[model samples]
Target: MPRWFNTAGPCRPDIHYMLPALRRLPDVQRLIAQEGYFVVHAPRQVGKTTALLSLAQELTAGGRYAAVLVSMEVGAAFPQDVGTAELAMLDDWRNAAEAQLPPELRPPPFPEAPEGNRIGSALAAWAKAEPRPLVVFLDEIDALRDETLVSVLRQLRSGYLNRPRSFPVSLALIGLRDVRDYKVVSGEEDRLGTASPFNIKVRSLTLRDFTAQEVAELYAQHTADTGQRFEPEALALAFELTQGQPWLVNALAKVAVEELVPDISKPVRRADIEHAKKLLIDRRETHLDSLAERLREPRVRRIMEPMLAGLALGDVPEDDLRFVQDLGLVRMAQGGGLGVANPIYREVIPRVLSSTAVASLPPQTSTPWRRADGRLDMARLMEAFLAFWRQHGQPLLGTAHYHEIAPHLVLMAFLHRVANGGGTLEREYAVGTGRMDLCLRYGPDTLAMELKVWRDGEKDPLEEGLAQLDGYLAGLGLDSGWLVIFDRRGGQPPISERTHASDAVTPAGRRVSVVRA
Candidate 1:
């Protein structure tokens, strides 16, 4: 039976693998045929290595190409020593090639390292003696030290002209970022552009996440193999939550199939997917941890902060945006705004970044809300939030995400606790939104909040606050809304002064309340 869920990488042969999408790239095939150097980059575990290995198998099976997939990841340990790094990389390559080669066609002794150009010359000599065109896929190409990486790229570029007859016909550098964005920063103000060494690269391809249809196709494979089916809603929820990120998609499916589902006879349901998501987040797997690490980077912060603030980031360099996109952190929409790439990522980001804040949240009163005839007391919830902010808001504000226009993460933590299980919070923020807008959906009742920070020496923010809240409520189809403003104008004021102040009125006959923290 096939393992439907895969997290490390794709399983061989029986994994219901998809190949046509990558094979369709024109440049990919051209390089494979004409002996060119290129790059295939995307977020870790998004299947860059898997796709390359699959291609390598296909090329080798044709009996017209000698293909090998080598990983440089192990060389990352001795990054500064080029000699040891090169040796480790070469050893990995030789082992992978020998293991994959058919017994009848295996070379007795692999090609030895030659002087001048270590990797390129050895590879060139191997191709020269081989009966087929040489194709090498260098995985984890970015793991090498800056100097060594430059040397390797330059060697490949120099040897490109001697293809099929004297050098490798096709060379691929697969890593976490595109080759073009590689900035080898060594000394003071010394930035070596990736293009300088790898100018011969005709194309850079990014392995994109599986689409909704693809996710469904992958799941159907398991059902066909073992007669264990995922419920229709469960399948939909899987795509909705994972947005087809390969690791998350496979991990969630694995949990549902191997753990959550009772037996082959029972169909996996949406609740199963929810359970899997919770387990994955709780476990804090390496895939999730690696992604969370990117959130702390300044470049990532610049791009993500504005989106969290519901405002557009103007004039950001294309490279920065592309880097984040490759990391699978954000996705661009047709309308030109950025959103959290997928549901799983969206959920993970808030949870990982707000751990401290969530732990310190104040306890709600037993009579948190007063009910009149089984209806929720919306006013009471607001009052509770106000009181909580007064006591714990400043301390929580210290944990606020500073890169964003406002402290959205802190506000989100507060809302997350209050609305947990009982309600849902929908977020809307883009590059140009200027403020973060959240709508709380509790049963049939709906409440909206707009969050902003005091930027300059503005004395009264009443007009801006009113306009913002009015727009949010209108969009949410609500009669009344709250505007929470954090007064950072005083530069970290005392906790006592961070009290909630409201000008109570129903402007435009739509209830509007402003809370100051």
Candidate 2:
């Protein structure tokens, strides 16, 4: 059978084109040799399980150690019942050991110790019974929470000193977060700090995404197997869009080859990759949907809200920022600041956040905002937008969840609705910036727009908005565009009094249309 890209669960080399799982985890062997207890973490589906399982097999086969990878995810279901969660987790460990280990190395039946201490007792009994030193990779250790999470980590800490005799010689806690990020909440919401619970961890290691060369090598495997090639530009575009995110790299290739262009004889092209990206975003596949679900979380909001508003983050906790980064949502920007991880995420974030408003957009009533020769008619488009803003902008802004970006989202939704068939809109915004830039592409025409907001106690931003738009237009090779400022201050003039449009010239001699609504 022909191997295809794998997106769900741990990748199997027999079926999926993949890089060596251990390439990004160079210290695992050394840590294990030193009898260390450590945490291995990365964003979801970045091959944590695959690497652990593969390493466990390799260790077990070496004839010197007994190794097994067991999952703690089942325990997460019984968070409130420590006894039941511990029992379930121990059972999972026994089952995994039996399947992966030889009879000589398989763990003995769990001990009859008390509920909360069973996991620790069982590990001690197994280590005592086994002939050789044992190593354990406890996958999804962070999935457990509250008392259950606390119980297991404490049990491991309790067993730390008995290595190679009364307990496993070494162990790894694998999940999406470091042990420090784990929370232990008790009655009345009492919490334990990081130092006490899982402090036995010698080090916390993170698995990184595939590098650019690794991504190419993965694609090359598919090409070698199927005799179909991805063009140079296509591979470059894939890396550019995904930033070497493993799942995204595979998903894009899978979509392009299997869905968008299936002719094995033909090479995949850059345009096909772009279309695949749009398809994935439009379909809201499970991966992207899962990411969107995190947007409502308080910690997620603290980091993302400022990003969307193009305002600097004000005193957000360092842990909160690190937590967001661990989830693969944001990364350090080239000029040294936080930004969305990649272009695909950059596009997905705003659209997903504004989906509700997009759904509520007024039906497009304007004739195609296109000239007879099929170019976008900027004048016609602006006329329709001014009319739409005057009619529905206020009501929509009132219903938006992100109040800071309400006006910007509403306008984008409107533009997205009108530009759906004939054009595409790209956006750029970042923390510490006070404006959102938009570039609309339609056939041979490119339209640049700059959006700013005047909140309470702030003066009109017309001069600054015009200057920014001038720079933006120059970048797009255009001499004219739109500078839209939304007046959100209280005690303002009525809509009829304040809503209007005018034209201005920039210091660089660029003409800009200024719209205040």
Candidate topping TM-score: 2
Model 2 stretches astray by more than 4 angstroms: 185-192, 362-375, 494-497
Quality of model 2 by C-alpha lDDT: 0.86
**Per-residue lDDT over 238-310 for candidate 1, one digit per residue giving the tens place of the 0 to 100 score:** 9998888888888898877888885999888898998898788768898999899887776787788777666
Residue 171 lDDT (model 1): 87
How far out, in Å, is residue 55 in model 2? 1.3
TM-score of each: 0.86, 0.94
TM-score of 1: 0.86
How many angstroms is residue 71 displaced in model 2 relative to the true structure, after the best TM-score fit?
A: 1.3
1-517: candidate 2 lDDT, tens digit per residue? 6788888988778887888999999999999999999999888878999999989999989998999999999999988899999888888888899899988888877779987898999999999999999899999987778889888888998999888799999999998878777656633123354565678888889988888888899999989998899999999999999999888999999999999879889999999999999888888888889888877777888998889888999999888888899989999866789999888888888888788888887666656577788887788888877877887887788656777888888888887885686778889999988999988888888888999989888778888888888888888899898898989888987664677888899889988788998
Global lDDT of each candidate: 0.73, 0.86
Candidate 2 global Cα RMSD: 2.3
lDDT of 2 at 189: 24
lDDT of 2 at 145: 82
Best lDDT goes to which candidate? Answer: 2
Residue 402, model 1: lDDT of: 53
